[model samples]
Target: MAKGYWITFYRSISDPGALAAYAKLAGPAITANGGRFLARGTAAKAYEQGIAQRATVTEFDSLEQAIAAHESAAYQEALKALGSACERDVRIVEGLG
Candidate 1:
């Protein structure tokens, strides 16, 4: 099966502390569910209208695993910690090959 990826874009961040807390929980949660970070942080440049202030990409062994990581209790805790501290978009996609 094709690999899966989680792509997240942060449009704005109103609370750094909340984001930090979310990251702390989310990182371990993702890893435990077979997800690995590929890229994270602000973009070097924006050449498109949809680009946000920050972007994150995580790879997973399969689409199911990617979705599972997002739904897992640990990640849910992270989301609760975040609690609208930022505006962001997240997408899960299957890799090309």
Candidate 2:
């Protein structure tokens, strides 16, 4: 099966509480759309080489499904809740097998 991944880049978080609120909604939205997180954490490498920021990777059964989740109303609402919280860079990549 082809898996899909969402690689996210974020700027230094100023409000962790807001992020937590976003995550609370985001987690369930993704699960409802058939996706799960692969990795989530601060950018540890920044300490050594000036990293871009934090990141979270979410995976789904297919790239189409991943994109669908991002466009879903529930996820869109979560994004709106997070929009003011942090700067973000996100992309969806297809996994090999």
Candidate 3:
């Protein structure tokens, strides 16, 4: 089966403390749902029209699991904590096995 990837690009983070709080809850929630964070932080370099920003790439056993991790009640709590602290784009894509 193809692996699932959850990618997030943070355009801006207005409140670092809120993000920190969300991470505390989100990490465990994601792990429980079979997520492995491969890379997370500001981009080292940007190319083309891309602008350097904070990003995260996570691998999941499957697409369903990735979706579940994002929607789970635990993750929902994390989102609540995050509130409107940042602007980000999140994507879930399938990759070759």
Candidate 4:
């Protein structure tokens, strides 16, 4: 099966402290569910209409595992901690075999 990836792009972060807290909790939760952080940081550059944003990419063994991680209680706690700290987009995509 193709691997799965959780892709997140933060358009804006209003609360640094909240974001920090979320990161602390979310990172571990993700790893606990067999997710690996491939990238986490600001974009190197933006081209055309692309908007520069903080982005994170996490890989998982499969789509089911990725979905499970997102639905887990630990990640839900992280989401609670995050609240409205940022405006972002999150997606789970299957990788090429």
Candidate 5:
């Protein structure tokens, strides 16, 4: 089954340079693991009040593939560089059967 990963980030972005650096590092890792970016930085027009500054959704061939991607060494390095610069909410879900 396909797997989906959703990530929401609320970041003030103290450093755009750092964000770009991290993106460069992580983007390739995901692609290498057979992941595809579905939506990124998509604005949500309707909500009660609080909302994430950015929302991203990605799909992988399988749940194991998704998990493996996140657990990969390259991604972990990129995630580490991200530090506490942003608050992130991430979830991995199996697609409908």
Candidate 6:
């Protein structure tokens, strides 16, 4: 099956503490649900329309798995901690292969 990926782009951060708190909770929650982080942190550079800000890429077994992980109760808790901390864009996509 094609892999699933969560692509997250941070538009802006309003609270570092909230992000830290969320990260502390989100990491384990994601991993426990079969998510593996592939890349994270701020971009080294942007090309064309790219936004060189904080971002992450997480992989999962399938698209449904990725969606489930995001919608899980644990992740929801993390989201609560992250409430309004930053503007972000999250996309769940199926792998080409």
List per-prediction Cα lDDT, in the order shown: 0.93, 0.85, 0.94, 0.95, 0.75, 0.96
Give the poorly placed runs of model 3, Cα more than 4 Å off.
none
lDDT of 1 by residue, 1-97 (tens): 9999999999899999999999999999999999999999998888867664889999999998999999999999999999989999899999987
Best by lDDT: 6
Q: Give residue 37's error in model 5 in angstroms.
A: 0.4
- Number of clashing residue pairs in every model? 0, 1, 0, 0, 0, 0
lDDT digits (tens) for residues 1-97 of candidate 4: 9999999988899999999999999999999999999998998997886568899999999998999999999999999999999999999999999
Q: Which stretches of candidate 1 lie over 4 Å from their true place?
A: none
Candidate 3: tens digits of C-alpha lDDT, residues 33-57: 9999999999999889666989999
Model 5 scores worst on lDDT over the 10 consecutive residues at: 4-13
Quote model 5's TM-score.
Answer: 0.82
Instruction: Indicate the worst ten consecutive residues by lDDT in candidate 2.
Output: 43-52
Model 4 misses residue 8 by how many Å?
0.2
TM-score for each candidate, following the candidate numbering: 0.95, 0.84, 0.95, 0.96, 0.82, 0.96
- What is model 4's C-alpha RMSD? 0.8
Q: List the residue pairs that clash in candidate 6.
A: none
Q: Can you list the residue pairs that collide in candidate 1? A: none
Looking at model 3, the pairs that clash are none
- Clash pairs (backbone) in predicted model 2: 46-51
lDDT for 51 (candidate 2): 62
